[model samples]
Target: MNSIGDNCTELKKKYDSCFNQWFSERFLKGDTDDSVCAPLFKIYQQCVKDAMKVQHIEFKEIEGDVLGSDKEQKVPPKSGSSSS
Candidate 1:
């Protein structure tokens, strides 16, 4: 998949390929250490962060949990429902 920043696509691809190789060859084999792709990931991450800054996207916005899974959500009672 292409990266959010076009300039980082190559870096992202490198990291993805490395991760895939590591996951299949090492992780699945019980060698769970993932530092093999850490450098590539860091480079790609920085590139994406730079692109986001250029586009005026705040880091806090991306940091938000859109799924709301961390907090309990109360469902409102349905209309016409009454306590017995």
Candidate 2:
């Protein structure tokens, strides 16, 4: 898959390749370390951020947890419940 930023595509590809190799060669073997692809990922991430800025998309807006995982769930009150 291509990156959001055209300029970042190469970096993303490099990171993806490294990650895939690491996952299959190291992670699957129980090595568990992922620093091998960190540098490439950082570069790709920065490029995407720059693209987002050029597109007028605020980073903070997309940084929120879309899954609402940290939110407290509220249960509906029972029909038999009475108000004060």
Candidate 3:
């Protein structure tokens, strides 16, 4: 099941398919072009944004705070930091 909604499932699948193909064929082949899946992804993104709005989700705030932030967070040291 999609996290967005049932209405976006089909679009998500289509976008996923396009993305997988692009990743495997073009990306792996060192083709950095993103035109192939751009359209599909754009539509899928719009659908997800609309669904999130309907669910009262603040997509921009979530995205900005989670991903757009440049602050570097520290990772805790492992219990055993020494090499075996």
Residue runs of model 1 more than 4 Å from their true location after superposition: 69-84
Taking every candidate in turn, the Cα RMSD to the unseen true structure, in Å, is 3.9, 5.4, 5.3
- Which lDDT value does model 3 have at 29? 97
> For model 2, where is the 10-residue window of minimal lDDT?
64-73
- TM-score per candidate: 0.77, 0.73, 0.71
lDDT (10s digit) by residue, model 1, range 1-84: 788888999998899899999999999999989998998888989999999999999898777565657454668899999978
- Which whole-number lDDT from 0 to 100 does residue 10 have in model 1? 91
Residue 80 CA error for candidate 1 (Å)?
16
Which runs of model 2 end up more than 4 angstroms from their true locations? 68-84
TM-score of 2: 0.73
Q: Write the residue-wise lDDT of candidate 3 on 3-83 in tens digits.
A: 477799999999888989999999999998979999988988898898888899896656545444555466677997985
lDDT of each: 0.88, 0.86, 0.83
RMSD versus native structure for model 3: 5.3
By summed lDDT, the worst window of 10 consecutive residues in model 1 runs over: 64-73
lDDT of 1 at 82: 97
